[model samples]
Target: MCKSRILLVEGRRTVGGGQIMSRRICDVLSTNYDIAVFLPDGESPLAELLQDYSLHRYPMLEYHSGKKGVSDVCRFIYNMWRTCRVLRRFIRKEDITVVYVQAPSLLPVVVCAVAGMDVQIFVHLHVVHVDRKVRLLLNVCLQQKCVKKIIGVSDFTLQQLSLKNRRKSVVLYNYIDDCIKKTVSSDTCEKPVISVIADVMRIKGHHVLFEALQSSALNVEVLIIGRIVEVDYYKELIDKKYSFQYTFTGYVNDVERYLEQTDLVIVPSVGFETFSLAMVESWGKGIPTIASDLGGMKELVENFLPQYAEILLFSPGNIEELKVKIETILNHDILYREVSEKVHEVAYNNFSKTSFRKKLLGII
Candidate 1:
């Protein structure tokens, strides 16, 4: 039997959690399927990451940030139509049997269905909060004949979809690659080093973490890694005075290296997150994480992996509670070590590449 030809569509040009997940999926599925990627026009950081696969570019597929005005809406519709036309041509040219779209974007699903090809369409939902217009678009896309499955990064995300679409929705957790697992460091610093690996956005709760750091009496080193998405917010954070020593490395390539050196990782997201890839990455490196007890972070820590609940979680936006948790992790050595080992065990058993591949292949 011949292998199926799969075309993965990513509508974004920037590097984000969704793009990263798509890259990993492409890397793994390429060995079993004929894989190609349809990305937005212009430079994409994911291109360097997915060097093994064939990349197809189409204009007007780049991500739209912030609120859209009347003109923006008109432009969006025009661009979407152009994108659909390009996608239709590519599907016919490549003879793709499966169309895997990263994130719950309506254009790709609708395009795949309208392309009039005998292909299975799989849409992955990574965020819970969708605009009203996007939600309506998704409903229309779900009704399409080609859309076969809707995969959510977490159960929280799946539940946000319309009830009619829930029947086809499945929860598929993100996985950490072998490179991250193999590079687990057994070393530790003299003072506790807390790291936050996320884009510098207000929703990520970097300001809240900074407040906690200021209030806490413990001596610690903070490493803020990732691109500065919000310039004013990041400026405000840097300008504010805090007792704890910290450094903001604006988007480093070697995330595993930072994870290896850190004593603990913190995910203080105030907004709804589909899944915290940083938490999983930390666990892969045998490091425990202190994440806000909200949305998917709460679901992962409190429900999915309850063993490390007590030490590895804090209420979202609670400065005092966050301070206490940081203090506990820094002051208590035995508890930290125990939680670190347990979380690492859970990550290896469940979130490893092998486990993810098995589950994904079963679904396919």
Candidate 2:
């Protein structure tokens, strides 16, 4: 019997959380489906990661961070038309039955709706909050007959959509990749190593972590592993003096190596997190993480990993509280080991690849 064909659409050119999730979804689905990815035309960082799957290049537009102008509007219109045309042709040529969009994009879903290919559209929402315009667009797309379902990375993300949209939405947590699962835990260092695996942005709360480190007398070495998206903010962070020793490894491909050596992981984000892949991945490796008690991070720890409860979560950007949590872990070895072992067991049982694939198959 022939397998159903799927076209995975990702609009972003750079490697980030959304791209990582998209790649994992493709990897899992490719076993049962004839899967191909549609990416923005250029040297995408995802190209190296998705070498096993077939990729279809298109003249996809990059995400604009600046204010919209008349030229921006014109470009948006042109890109939409171009993308729709390309997708329509690919669907017809490949006889694709399903089109799974990685991040919520209005243009691609609209294209699939009107393409007249008898294809089902699945939009996986990775963002916790979207602007009014994008939210409106998503609502309109969700109403389309061709759009089968809306997948959210977390409950927080699903709640952001309208009530009508919620009926058709489902929450699917991101799973730990095989590479991270293969990581062997190392012995705790003489001076404990704490790891943070988010881009250097203000919203990610790098400054808050530095402040916590400065205020505390804990002797821990910090390992920061991510790209420097905000140059000025990063420069500002590095320029200031701190009490704790830290090293920044900008944009490393393999995060498992750093995760393995560290005694603990910290996710101190001031902004809302849809779902933290870093936290889940670290837990899968039997490592305990101290995350900000906000958004999905709070939900994941409090609800999913309730064993750790109050001990693992701290108020977002609260340096004193964060410092206290870190010190608690560092000061007490028994507490640290107990939390680590329990969290790893829970994560492995709940967030394994086998469980994720089974859930995904049910939806597909």
Candidate 3:
């Protein structure tokens, strides 16, 4: 049997929920396939995070400008031409079997702009929030007819795409390794700790969490474990004088450590995401999360996160209402402990590495 040459494409520096999902699947698939990855050209931590696995890597053009009324047609053409040079070279050298790319089309619609080729292409549609422009792009991808498959991280993401893309879509939930799964322990201490784990991007709603904490009547001590993705944004939040009772562990090695000590995982997102990997990770840990009512989260209620989902619902951006509910949750220890004990089994059974690998193999 010939080795399947797999080409994975991503468009970010730091790892988000969807990217992490893709990475984990790729890591497991790497056992048999000859793997390579094309990330956007920049200094991203994703490049380093992927280093542990044996895979070839490339960096494509970071910008994708077209009919959105771009200033330079020549520059766009030049980038596309440059991309063709690299992709063609990779195909020949690697004897590529399948190309797995991410959605909202990275490499700046190069695949769509150029004529279709013979290499089998699979697009991972992680876009849960579809505005007018995004809907347009996926339509273009569907029209191309070169795309072989579309993997939606959740059903919510599948519905956002056109009927054509939907026809080719499949749902493969994100997962964590056994190493991490074994470490998913609930906080057994008397004082429950609430922690938020995510990049400090404006879309992540860390600021909203601060507001939620300030307004809450519960005296819960909070610890945040994530990278300060933007220096300016981090500075802005610190400047807001709401920094009390919050410890920012800006980008650390192990997230499981924070999860080990954390009781309540707060997922306050102001924007949409295909699937929340951190939320799944928390579920894997048997630690309940309080997430926003918006985005794909509504459909992805699982493990500990799902158990707490009922009380965690609040109007998007409504901090005052969030505070009131949070206070109510914290005050009720009997309910908290009841849910906490149940998640331990759910987290391991549903999201362990065995299940993740089995699902991937079943699909492929």
lDDT leader:
2
Question: What is candidate 1's lDDT per residue for 61-130, written digit by digit as tens?
Answer: 3345544457757666766687777787778777878888885554443454456568888888887645
Over 1-364, each residue of candidate 3 has an lDDT whose tens digit, in order, gives 8667777777666676666666776778787786777665655678677776544444454433223325344444555566656666766776766777763555344363334556667777777534466467566766566676677778877887777767777887666664243333233455558888887877778888788877655556678778786788888888876534678888875887777777778778888766777766776666666778876676666423565567756666778877776666566667665655555556666667777778666555
Report the C-alpha displacement of residue 32, candidate 1, in angstroms.
1.1
Rank by lDDT (best first): 2, 1, 3
Show model 1 residue runs off by greater than 4 Å.
Answer: 61-68, 106-113, 179-188
What does each candidate score in C-alpha RMSD? 2.4, 2.4, 3.6
For model 3, the superposed segments whose C-alpha errors exceed 4 Å read: 41-43, 54-79, 107-117, 129-131, 178-191, 302-308
Model 1: lDDT equals 0.78
Which has the better TM-score: candidate 1, or candidate 3?
A: 1
Q: Candidate 2, 8: how far from true, in Å? A: 0.5
> At residue 145, what lDDT does model 1 achieve?
69
- The C-alpha lDDT values of all candidates are 0.78, 0.80, 0.67
